[model samples]
Target: MESPLEPLLDGRTKGFPAAAGLLRLGQVGSMGWNVLAEDLPLPLAVLKETALRHNSAWMRAFQDLTGVALAPHGKTSMSPQLFRRQLDDGAWGITVATVQQLRVCRAYGVTRVLMANQLVGRQAITYVLDELARNPTFVFYALADSVAAVDALAAAAAVRRPGRSLDLLVECGVNGGRAGCRSLAAALAVARRIKAAEPYLRLAGVEGYEGSVPGPTPDQQERRIAEFVGFVGEVAECCADEGLFGADPVILSAGGSAYFDMVTSLPRQLGPRATQVVIRSGCYLTHDSDAYARAAVRMRERTPAIASLGEGLRDALEVWSYVQSTPEAGLAILTMGKRDVSHDLHLPYARVALRPGRDARPRQLPPDCEVTALNDQHAYLRTTEGADLAVGDMIGCAISHPCTTFDKWRFLPIVDDDYDVVDAVATYF
Candidate 1:
């Protein structure tokens, strides 16, 4: 069968240099184009190949140590190529936030999908049922935090009557979080409703997102996360005892990029119930320089196992842009801005600078230099006095949130340590 990714190999991809002229994505490696050498367009987003491999392996090792399965959230980098990498690296399944993302995974031949969010809406529900009926080998799971959601899904499943029941994980959420049931009692009620739906719907397990569980302090936050995980575990146990669980090994999933160690405690709480603890960490694949890096430090402090896993996750993604203008002292306008990188949690930071002909090699930008603000196509870079920055100097920036950044670009080149393009991945959104 022809690979689904073959279409993305076109030379017309956003970041591909026009001079390369209709080259295959795999052939980019042999073309000898280097980022620092100015072989491609500036304001380009690229992934460090070595760091990508390391992060994947590190997460795999973490899963092995914790005895849990990973269903890496696909919403972070809606790129099918990255999905292939995660699947090849031993991801149990690709977790998406929408039915459109599920379609992308299905188009690329992903056999298993976990829609981390609730599968609502008639169109979305019908699409899922169609897929389940078409592909016998396919496995899918979605979240449900309310009786209405369970009933909605059950209604769609009953109408289609696919070969098997639609699997659903009851979502247990925090008071002010995004989705899921706000209380344990609410979560159990939803799970029981799912069981009542019978042959149309199956209670797979309980799941939640701990990243939104707020804590006034770090200690309080950890305590709240523990409490939230415990709440989810309780829901699962109650459903199991009531014979509400439809799957043999009930799944207890929750874990964003941060606080996965605490989420791993689900298995311990289940206590003899056949369960599969799955962590849906999306950003761990291309861990950012800002938010997730700080989270990693806290994770190591709480879980000694991470520190012992050789070197930790490095920032694999970087956006390189030229210094469009150095109009005044201590100020440089970069070609990259909100359109190219991320600024949701923290603004992109200047990491390295390279002058095309004047510099011998790329040098680390001064610690005092920072991205003060961003415009649609320009960034306000505040440099320390005598920072040696000049017009035309390429500035490589490290983003804060990989999810937002990955969505901005349709394609990101995978580069080696020397900044040579090795491979490229295409994003759907």
Candidate 2:
């Protein structure tokens, strides 16, 4: 049987073997394509099948240990295939940042979606309302930090009359942070506004993004995160006290890729409010090598519970590029650049390398070998003295931020430990 994703596999798709013409997505494994064997093109982004499964299971265990639900941010991969994997692994719902992402989830038969961002604009608002009216089982929640946003959503919901109330989470934020009310009083105001909107707009719960809260030191950051999460809980409690929350299990949603350990304390803070704590840690599915990895180490130190849980998330994503140029003695230019992998948080790290003919397996890149810079189509890999790297050698780099890397490719191959292509996932954005 032809796989539903077969249409996405063709000659034009990046990372796919160009000579293999119009193969079905399901037949990728049978093609015997191996990255080390040079069956596919260079600068290909692939997901390690083993690592992917490990990361998914690890997150499931974390959720079970913490007793907090996960609505992993969909913006991380934007791939419906991965969303299915997370849902099947027991995710509470998929979290999105925009109406477009929510649309993708809805199209793929995702019944529950939480838009962590405020729902604005005529077209975006109309789309959500249309989806709600069209599907009786569709459950949606969006953030609102101000009365203006609440009024706009209420106006749209009133006009559309989707026959169901538009659930909203009053966002609480800190100064100098991203969207959300900057003060507890402000958050209560938004919650009250959402409550006043009545049948049109429902104050389902309170939400915030602790990742944006700044601190100069790790301890300071963790302290601020705890304080910010406390504020989010306070908003939920105030809403409950005022009879503002419309949902039966008031949702207290927060937690970005970092600080989920602290965000999990929301349930404890709420005590017995009949609250549902949802952590939106999107990058946990395909853990990164840089920023997130460092954060994980700190997470274990602060939260002993996470430390007790065997091994944490492993890096599942990698971009393989060939040594295209050996321009200088200390530098090797790689085929992958800003267009292929993520360079937002940190430059991609050279993890492993395999020479075309000489090396039987991939060897660890020298500890000193670092990605110093990247251009539109090339990476400047700075190698230590006497590092055995040459043109045509395959270099696999682990990215820092999975969110930016996943957006660069429409389709990414899922490969086994030996780099054999086992499956493929298509990204919506």
Candidate 3:
């Protein structure tokens, strides 16, 4: 298991073996050890290879079925290995949120990247232009939600005006949402402004995020998301009709792991233009147990085929820890906590419990088991069935909100179905 990422998984990394160079990242824990054998320390993050492959293929097939391309947002697992896998599996391009992430992608030999956010500072513009110039075949795109942003991007691109215009997309935003233009008029103006920039900036397409569309309930949210995505489609058509696009095969993208069904369904009437519709869904690469899990059900409800495909997306990421204490009858303290896993949307759910030689295989958690609370480095787990209670026992916990969980681990081990370490992946940030 002495892989290229061995240096990053040494003793310096959290939860790694304390003895430097004692074990490589992918080697079976020391002395033919397995997860159930407690060969590694507690609070270890592991990715199920089977689930990872399933989610990746599921998302790609979903995109192919909808007749769109995937530029999976790389911010979810900033792992170059995952990016390469996605690209190799037929991803059109990789999408990033910041210039720093852009650097990471480029460093890993990503030729095409879509910066899904606005390019603001002068240094960022210069870096992008310089990188573009360094590689003639490079295809990079940024978002522009306002005339001021377009102007700033234009001025910054002028620093390297190397006979090529910077590619950009007019971002359409919703009321009280994140970045982007709140009105069609405003977005259209931004597109026109990009066209006005002429040789310095190129209006390539339109961008939007349907994940946070406001609605009172699930049905209402889905309906409103459909409407908002339709608005983005209208904006794309408007930009195309007005001759605002700088080139052919315009890009129209709007998907954020949630409500991608709406993004694909509502934009079917894109005027039959030569456009490559892309969905920027990153979390589907490692589907979680909450938030996105509910969305997946909705996605399957909207499209029944996805549900029949290997249970949609299985939960891939898990944090394995041991029961540290059971001071109370129903409450037990786990070694894992906020520092070890994610608790943004929902707390971790117990999946399996093992007692070394006593159990031949991992067992599912009792129906009454639950992770109630978490401190900086402790998890308070409660179980109604007293038989499931004990200290020094191993438990595998499935995480929610994968985005928040990934940023906490720099190096994650990839394990097979039996939880044996097979390979490893390193995250940049």
- Return model 3's CA RMSD, one decimal: 2.4
For candidate 3, the per-residue lDDT at 128 reads 94
**C-alpha TM-scores of all predictions:** 0.96, 0.96, 0.94
The residue-by-residue lDDT of candidate 2 on 138-250, one tens digit each, is 99999999999999998989999999999999888888888889987888888889889999888888898999999998889889989998888877877787888774788
In order, what lDDT does every prediction score?
A: 0.88, 0.88, 0.83
Estimate the TM-score for candidate 3. 0.94
lDDT by residue (275-335, candidate 3, tens digit) is: 8788898998888888889888788887776655656888899999989998988888999
**Clash pairs, model 3 backbone:** none
Where is model 1 more than 4 Å wrong at Cα?
A: 1-3, 8-12, 268-272
Q: Residue 194's C-alpha lDDT in candidate 1?
A: 90
Q: Model 2: what TM-score?
A: 0.96
Residue 279, candidate 1: Cα error in Å is 0.2
